[model samples]
Target: MICPRCAASLTGKQRSGRICAHCGKRFALDPAVHGKGMHDIRIRGIAERATDHGRLKITLTQLWYLSRTRNYAWAEQDPQGVPAGIRWLVALPVAVALLLCAVLTDGVLAFVAGAAGCVVLVVASAMRHRPGRPPRSQIIPSEETFRQLMTGAWSTAYGRLPKGVVDDARPVPRPRGASRSRASAPLSRPTAVILCTDRVAALFLTANDIPGRLGAVLLEAAGTEGTAGRSDIVTGALKELAEYRSALPVVVLHDADPLGVLLAPLIRAAQPDRVVVDAGLPVSAARGKQGVVRLARHNRFADAEQLRTVAGLPEADAKWLADGFWSPIAAVPPRLLESIVVRAVERALAAPPPGPRHAHTNGFLTWPQAPQTPHARDTGRPGAGTSKREGTSSA
Candidate 1:
């Protein structure tokens, strides 16, 4: 194992103390790292190493003063200067000089000069103590650099590149109580197919009973199966859609990041005629929401491709994505995600057949019911509401 604190290679003996001989720093091995998986540990280690040297240090005097002070708002307010009394003493003479000049000169010209002097003083005072740029270590790692380090560290620790979670080529298990007879079995097409960005999101949704409630099939778009060039599950899903000729909606549930937003578009390319809705975490939902995990800087082949594919997105969104801001679908409150999925499924199920003009409008589509016609609104027969006397007179 490599010492996370020093980045030095460690032998089996050194692993026992979890200490780095080079840096003389001791690290407590987090049980979660080994318990969960090595991938997470690697990511954390990379982030730590990237920032450890870059962290800014404060002197003891500064720390003591900051702790003792009540009025000082470090980083928020400017540092206190010469006492207010001293400032006033200096400003009084300047003010008196300005007043004398104003009285001696044209009032308008004097006023303008006085205003300019005040502006300069304020600007100089404000600029004098402005904070400098934070250390690079304090700044979050860039997506590219973070990914490189994560990948390199993983390779060094595991002797191989990390793989996607859903890379297995095996077929998905059939639902329980499916028909036994192959020929006579009824075709079971889901109302909507839910595509996840990764395996964790898929597993989370599965654990939360999303499939049972929504009757949707969950798929990982960048799963190992897709990356390995043997996407049996995806192929099977596309085949099923073709075979059933079902107008089933495809819902993409992904992270609230650049790559996730593009999942719907990728799925749409496969089924151009089908409706594809982004049920994934949206930017709005991600904001102020807690438990949002960041995407690992390093990406597998599919992930890199996804980033490339979304290049044509609007400048702001593209920049945000490129900067590596992401929140996984699991970060969303499970109940909220479940509710969103339920509503999406219900809407899809209730949607009317597409019209000629709406055939291509299924991309980024919503499920809104068409307005009811006046004839359809009538509850009884055409003449049923008429009075009996009126009916008899008409007869």
Candidate 2:
């Protein structure tokens, strides 16, 4: 391998560290290229775990899709995480009702008997399904937070060079009049980059434009794809965070409000003594709606903004708080938001700071899509209720 910076021949041993010795350029590596299979398995396992429990989140739009096309078994199951007891209970009443129907109908009038049994079965099942658990709210960290984490330094930051090094503003040709040799070959800018966004759609949009990088996590999506809290997975993701080898930077970009504010703290909580920067500043303290306003009222609230003097939005957009579009979204917490923030914050420090405007629209916000129907989870699905097993189990 050759150092992307100084064009020096990089021995395998020297390549072990994620920097070029000749030019002191740091880099981020692709987790996908490093070991696609292993990561796939981990992701699949997490997805399965989410499916088994009611914790898995599927948007109503997706549920409608699955209902129309996928297997019936899948439709009944919750992707994030579902309770085991409910599975058995749902099966129990159907069996009992059929047995009672058979005994009372003298085992004749099979069709009519079956219909009656099903009616009873449906009613009992409805009764069993009554209010399992309160729904958990989906939380999304805001955008523009990448700067927030990097406002100061902590541990080292890593990232991959943007693709298209061939025609890049900085070309990769042998030094003028230099002899041709492996030592003279320039390093390739990595194919893709990583970033963190609380909203999956917004992350996709960012990743979509980056030549080749794909957003690894979708915080608002269904199943374990977005959920956090698996130590092994989190550790692996963190390990990936710690080890990339591109001269370019990885970043954790999130909103400037409450959720984004939490990104730095969350990363520090994961790895202490590490300094992270706050990428974008909140437009002002008065612009503090969502968690900002909510937290401001709290006893620990600091950095109160003087709305009177704050200028227009940070870079390009309007005021961060007054904009009903982004403010409400700043409140919700999405599952994948944390990891996305971590990735974006790391990237922002290495790359140019992002412009002020965010990419998401009103439709992208979670609360608006919340279950208008009774008992819908804020994540946009049915709420979980207490298990019959937890209540008075009737044998």
Candidate 3:
């Protein structure tokens, strides 16, 4: 690891204390204290990738997922079940030793040892753990810890979070019975309405003031019904917006997960006459075929079969979703996602008013700017932004 302050390579000084030997600056996150993977270099790299070289801002939660070291898939049959390979690797040596003993010594003791080995194999195979997704479970450090580390530890050490890093996880005061209002003021004719499904993405939009900058009304698929409220407010706002400016196109942003991918369709279903564009993460980026971050969750949705009928997912896509695996839109690099949403809004505005169901799935090739532009995050290091989605991963 290198000292973030002086850019000097650490020479075993950080192990004993936070003070840098070369720069003498007291750093916040000592790898010794935070774990092997937690260090200044890693954090800097993550921020760079997430923020797209300071052109975009990344949420702390999205930073949390981007900082994760492992890639995993969910198995609904057993979320906590150990992998068969692990069991075999553990028992193989013992079984081989027991067989050798039984063969070398023709005694009852050897037979008993072999029997014990068999029992050990059975115990290992039968072992069960508390049900949990390998990805995004308690075993993985909580977002709170990551938040504190960045806010309390990292900030204290570095003065503040790196450029373009936003802490979206922090709680904010909400209006009481706010949802009842259901967008009291209808949009005043923005170019388009952005309907984002994931609450995090909605928060991201607010943290960056994306709606204001783009002249769009941003709405979440959830919330604004209670507490902050519900989708009814979203529905009401859409209806009002449609009525106010019937030709105003709606841009939909969502995760690549099965349920998330269908949110655009849901919006279109409710407002059949309007033009809705989906600029959210696509399944191709989350399917692991593209080598993006595809994480697991307990997605035992009763409507598992509806993925195909509702979202037009292929058999492979449907099967992947039915397995309780998904990729969050947060996984996409912050700037790239912004560009996608922006481009989607532009597309929505340009798209002819929906005379029929004008539906299409957008991918990386059609997502953002030309290749000459800078790259945003997801992968460990900053590289050229390719036609393929960059920094694509799920927690």
Candidate 4:
């Protein structure tokens, strides 16, 4: 047996109980009494809207005319379920004839001719209909059933992108612990700084012990080495920046190539002005080295002066250069900066400070919301007397 509503297969239990599992449409089958053998099938409620509503009677009339008009007299069963229709054939000819008559006749004559023909056509079309059609449930599916015919085709064409793809492309989720109303609260101290460098740069540093030295100075200044890559550094940096009592910098150490430049801007956009710093050896110097010259072929920040201060370059950088990686830049050799480090430590010992005075929090530490442009800092601009760089250098 088949479901009268959706046409899905049904078992003996479904026919006996009047409930179809596939579409949940119910039916009532009653055996005739008094020696009669006929069983009448009555439709009950449908879980889903029925597709066959009001179709049987009109379909039967359409099929009768369609068969007679097409000369299909040998059809053994009703043509309603066999996908035949007379209007399809007549409609094309009527359209062509109307256009031809309209063109041949002029003004009022053309209008009257087309109008009379249309009236006659309408009456003839109505007269061709057959009456006393079966219920829509009894009408079968065929090529002429336009809605059912297109159902599978439409589903096959456009059902690829699921519903939630548009929603998934929305911006990153808001920080888990950030409070917008209290965005400017005082942060904790000894803020961590993680540096992400390219694998090539990592190799050079590893071979010459450059990273270990750089890590030492950075460890003294900040505290940690952050990872590189276009991952969730935003969340990590935000946590570190928010917790640091003072402004700590998160540095990105990459080659001066196109990839490094692109990565810099991404980090900038991720946190805007909040200490996602880029500290790579200038491209000019990177390209000037003998063995390392090829690595700087596509220097990304070649146009921009990446570092303005000698201290910003990791201590390991100066050591590597002085060891002969960068001897071409005639202005100032890396060895000279190494001497500056030794002298600074000597001077600091000579005037040993009374004691370390650590303040738990500053009243203005978290005053302004995240600085708008790099110029206006949480402390102050780089140019003014109130600038945060008392003994520090700006890049």
Candidate models: Cα lDDT each: 0.44, 0.31, 0.64, 0.31
Provide the lDDT at 221 for model 3.
67
TM-score of each: 0.39, 0.24, 0.68, 0.21
For residues 1-395, what per-residue lDDT tens digits would candidate 2 score against the true structure? 55545667766556455565667775333122232111212322332332233332322221111111111000112233324476556756776776667666753565566776667556554543232222121211111221121121101322311111111112233323333332222223332233343343243222222212232222221113222422233345345545444333333344444334444344444543333333322434324322221211111111224222222234322322222212222222322333344444344444432223311110111112211211112222223433111110000
lDDT of 3 at 182: 33
- Total backbone clashes of candidate 4, pairs 3 or more residues apart or in separate chains: 8
Per-residue alpha-carbon lDDT of model 4 for 1-395, expressed as tens digits? 55555677667665555556777755333222111111112111110111123211112112111111011001011222212256646664775687679779899978976886677567545554332221111111222432221233222333421111111112323233435432222121223243434332222222222223333122211122223332334344344345443334444444433334334345444444333444443544443322222111111121222222222334444333222222111111122222322333233223322223312111001111211211111222222221111111110
Worst 10 residues of 2 by lDDT: 66-75
Task: Show how many residue pairs clash in every candidate, following the order shown.
Answer: 5, 77, 12, 8
CA error at residue 132 for candidate 3, angstroms: 10
Off by over 4 Å in 4: 1-189, 199-246, 289-291, 296-395
Candidate 2: lDDT of 328? 22
The all-Cα superposition gives candidate 1 an RMSD in Å to the true structure of 22.9
Q: Show the colliding residue pairs in model 1.
A: 147-297, 147-298, 166-224, 167-224, 167-225
